[model samples]
Target: MLTEERYAAILKLLEEKKAVSVLELTELLNSSESTIRRDLTALHRMGKLTKVHGGATSINGVYQMTEDKTSVRHNLHVEEKNRIAQCAASLVHKNDFVFLDAGTTTERMIDYLHEQDAVYVTNGIVHARKLAEKGLEAYILSGKIKAVTEAIVGTEAVHSLQRYHFSIGFFGTNGMRAGDGFSTPDIEEARVKTEAIQRCNKRYVLADPSKYNQLYSVIFADLSQAAVITTALPDKQLRSHTTVIETDLGKEQTSS
Candidate 1:
């Protein structure tokens, strides 16, 4: 395997096992002992893992704040995102108006929503296109499109979102906790999310377990304001403020 591929493999293993010995990594990666050592050294230097005498351990299991492109994110947690999306979409009934926040998980919501008789307002450029292709009524928010996530943000989008109240507002966040509820990396996007949350009657944040307890660049709304639809329930600390609805994704059915 290539060096980058080996590195990613090792990291994925570490994520599952938390640590791995040299023999295990070498066999798992199908590489020589010397090669595994070299890869470990390189990863250690990059601060992605901690290289010990004969193996490595993960620094922390929390998701980092780095912003990945939307395309890359779609396949990262497909099953879990779909589960969250499915549950979120179920909340919509005929003639209900919904607000969709721009993120990979939120985008997955459109896949199941194709059959729902709901009117949609969204800030995701790609989401609007997908909704339209599915023959749903979708309104794309008006504003500047963010390069990384393709989310419509800035003053115009926030102001436009405030104009309409929604029956349900579904959002995906970079991170969430009790204090910094649903947050993102950009203040402009945060503003839009904050505005939408206020305009909606029932607000829900679609965050898989991977997003819980992690903090990001800005806080949009507190946990007290919204419900959480996720595969795993949050800890007692987070549950004190927000309502968490847990769903069994049957994720093992389709994870490649």
Candidate 2:
């Protein structure tokens, strides 16, 4: 491929997948490894992408480097979150093993869960109590509680997740973008979220429409790792990256 064409392909991959491997790029572009490396370097120099150890990442990954208190975040997008959560909760069915990530939107999901036979494993303190009230079997991982988010995170929480794999995991992110993937500000929580996603059979991220274009410090997974359950999806690039269930418009816009 021509150098300009290779550059465009690389950026498109970063925009849709959030990250790209050098080895994969060479094969995709029908170019040499060195040529792909040079293209990535040029893009990085232009402030178009960030060069990582073995790949490139989009520059629009994170906008906020810190997480807000759960109570504060819970009130920020109340209606949008509810719609997103409801759409996500509908994915669960009886006898499913679910992983509930620690976030306000995931917490909102507690109100919409219709699966009485689903067993849950979570890292959120609030999530456990709410689960128990409904007489569902819920396990809370052991770890130091984060005061701001009221979620457990640390070595223990990360280790605990290794024991069980979920049928599907529901998550919320501090930052969202076609190029940013699912990200959060706290590295500790990011670690636990990372482990959970790895152990789960499938992943789903619950986010409000406003989350798009936002960035956080740590990316836990690529946009392709999960089907996004959100109120609206306005980014065309994002629409092509992963499956999106739009609650506001009552339409499912799916792509491969």
Candidate 3:
């Protein structure tokens, strides 16, 4: 099939499923992985779709960015998240107070933290447990436990977060746009993120390439609000406005 034909088919699949994986596309188009990757790259450059780990998702649609446990469990681009987590972890120093947001991307930091004298605050129940197991001072905010994502979100959590300030706060979001800013689907989640941002001395947004240019329910912060963005290849337009650090796990940080 011609490249145009393959791309058209890919777009149609994206419309139907709202997302498609490279493996799936390879099987559907009877093409090689390299060819499928190239197709995704080209389509992503045109802003027609957002690329995810092994797949792509529709850009124009009513997409809900929810914290479903099953979805998070099946999250594909974990390597990128690990890379981001490592980069985010590097910013931590001894005795620093850090607030880690609740998300799979932020959760990856649990394996990389080596600081022993740090106070780690988070609304992620799983993350708090991990921090505890690692022998760090973990503060788990009180709030409504969201079973779907195992996260705490509500006024209680937001109120609790406002009481403490952090030396650095790391957050992750569902969708981000230049004008609309960083966003999440849940209002309570957005509230917690915004509170964390305001209470921290420095703010970092942890996102994979899949999240850039997407939109959600509420805006948490703008591009200027972030000290750095650690991700895979982020959208070029978004990169132009902020300090974009591109990394493959174990590679030197390339500033874009």
Q: Arrange candidates by TM-score, highest first: which order?
A: 3, 2, 1
Which of candidates 2 and 3 is the stronger one according to lDDT?
2
Model 1: which ten-residue window has the lowest total lDDT? 247-256
Go through the candidates in order and give each one's C-alpha lDDT: 0.80, 0.83, 0.78
Report residue 117 deviation for candidate 3 (angstroms): 1.6
User: How many clashes (backbone atoms < 3 Å, residues ≥3 apart in a chain or on different chains) does model 2 have?
Assistant: 3
The residue ranges of model 3 lying beyond 4 angstroms of the native Cα positions read: 16-24, 41-47, 50-67, 70-74, 249-256
Clashes per candidate, residues 3 or more apart or on different chains? 0, 3, 0
| Top-lDDT structure, candidate number | 2
Residue 122, model 3, lDDT: 93
Model 2 spans > 4 angstroms off: 1-62
Q: What is the per-residue lDDT of model 1 for residues 38-149, given as tens digits with 9 covering 90 to 100? A: 9988998897876654577665545445677888877665666887899888778888899989999988888878545789999999899999999898899899989899
User: How much does candidate 1 score in TM-score?
Assistant: 0.73
Poorly placed runs, candidate 1 (over 4 Å): 1-65, 249-256
> lDDT of candidate 3 vs native?
0.78
Q: Which candidate tops TM-score?
A: 3
